[model samples]
Target: MCVRYLGFVLLVWFTGVLRAQSAALHCGAPSLSGGYLVPEQETYSHESELTYACDNGRKPAVEGWWATSTCQNGKWSHEPQCIDEKACIPPTIPNAKYTEKLNGWYEEGHKIRITCDEGYEQKDQDATAECINGIWTSVPVCERSTQACGEPPKIPHAVIIHQEYQEVFAVDSELQYECEDGYTVEEADGKKSIFCIAGSWTKGPTCRIRPGTGLGGSTVGGTHGGHTTSTGSGTQPASGGGGIRPGTGLGGSTVGGTHGGHTTSTGSGTQPASGGGGTGPLTRHVSNCGKPPIVPNGEVLETNRLFLKYRCGTFYKLMGPETVVCYSDGTWSEVPTCRVAYCAVDTDEYPDLKHAGVKYIKDGESLRFECVDLWLVTNYSEGRCTDGRMTFTRCCNKFQLNTNIC
Candidate 1:
């Protein structure tokens, strides 16, 4: 008797272990390029689906900006990929302008027409300017007319890049300039652009020494307390030093810096430290939830920093609230579950039941069952499905009229 009891206990324990393992099945995180998946997580439960959003000028391999993938037993049903949409940036032609309004970036195979300025003509009238594979092809060139502006003026500390050899430049012709080492053009963002006007070229920008060098009179250092200070009260440096004019600071550098740093310097001459490397202010958390939680067999319909709405898949009923609120601590309200809304029956167990081979009966739908030739059932002929379950009033064999055989 004791041996039989021990054997039964072992069998029950093994079944419980197997049930736990099957219930906890999950898939590892999936990776995507040129885009990111929503509701990112380290692991996802079985049969869970996720949607991804692509970056600009790129689309998922499947279709539009958004695509979905499902996590099967241990692998992804579809691997997500974001591919280049093959869009081209607007092309610039010297002494000419596009006829249509430039829409920033043009899709593949898009074409644009150029109209030369008053005193210029296209070098190749038959050339077609079109976008192909994210590049412009056969761009029209506007040749200079007899009545044109003189050669472009040379800047003191700058040189032309990819300068085309031309004796004369037409009105509205433009050129790109690059400043020498240790020097930067005034108000120029990396490239110095100059264009010809009615009869003369635009004023060329001057390049001055870059700040933060130990050789120049300007000194940039961090204080003992780990804060950077840029003072502009000192006298101007000699012509060799690349200091700013009387009261200006380095272009684009903000005083005090970002990430909660504070600036104490006065006057417009003050600026942030070079490279923004010095230690600054303490960081603080923002009151916002970056991503919403993933819902199996469901999707997020509306999303915001503090709230979101969820919807379940077809034939699945939601068991909790449709909307969830995010707290300041970044935790969300109780998430809902998408409960199955269909009833399934075993065909092998009830061969006499009519349509027992049917896959499933949707919620609120009815199904009829039959017994064997000599057996009869009362109130078990028709049953309605509900919430993954089905009920019948009675089940009995022909001889056991008063007993429920099932």
Candidate 2:
């Protein structure tokens, strides 16, 4: 102890200034991530330990979690941490689809709810997947319901220009398309169609765009607010009854937020659509996009701008479109895909440890670990395959379950 500290303490004691001194070894209540601590303390004199537990919908990510932290001299020996509750991956089955898209990937303590597609029925089973400990417990399969064509596949940068009232594309039925502005149909093969041949539709042509129409030359309206301007300078059109020339339009999303609509120049009184649209109260129009994109083994995880968040199935990770915009023009900003994955565990590392299920687990797959009889486990017994990795608790078993090695 420093002489100054002792002198100050003596002065305070004699003057009664130490009367307001607080309890010894006072500390803030134990703080933990994804969980809370039991028996939070305000003051401590002797060494104490804290018990930790994950909150509802959360689980421990790593194995061998200590579950407790020690407090000594007002300082914690180690911090307690736990994983957030996870959800199961989207259920996958051939000739089937989710009844409704989900907002996020499956997680621990959550369930997958869905139904079979039209003309298809469950082969005497339920369409559900349970999320257990950050892994899917089971996946449902859907058999063929009908032989006719299911929903036509979605084409990027394009939409269904024509369809019947029933929307059923029966055998020999045909679907046509007209690409959105700034995008054009495949002119090479000239196959912009969906022909319901037999039970499946032929490969549909994709839409293509160059990204910009007019760049350098002054545009009637700049790309600031997704508006089109009429290129004019108080001049008349060419001798051929030329009115004001149309200005270049912007593509993708505009700064001012108008989309899935057309941009025309209102120059020279020849046209009257570019004089800055009305500022009157806007009326809500029906969404052009038919619900959000439901990618194969994925769902609309979140709604951002027009861009959406697409979460892949359990074990699988997303390849593209972390953000997408739902267009008012009945088109997807950019759809995403979910790629299959393999587990990230190294089986060779655990000698004498036996595992069942996939020797090398795949994403969304699970494996069980166990020790020989008379032996005990120090780490988690199960591992869930997710995104090329496994989230498991630590294991260290050098002794028997009920008896210590002495």
What is the alpha-carbon lDDT for the whole of candidate 2? 0.51
Off by over 4 Å in 2: 1-286, 289-294, 301-309, 326-330, 341-351, 359-368, 373-406
Candidate 1: TM-score?
0.24
Model 2, clash count?
A: 31
Output the lDDT of residue 10, model 2. 89
lDDT of 1 by residue, 305-405 (tens): 34678987655678899988753223567788777676765434664453222334678887555544344333334556876677653444434433534
* Model 1, runs deviating above 4 Å: 1-287, 304-306, 355-358, 369-380, 393-406
In candidate 1, which residue pairs clash? none
For candidate 1, give the lDDT of residue 362.
70
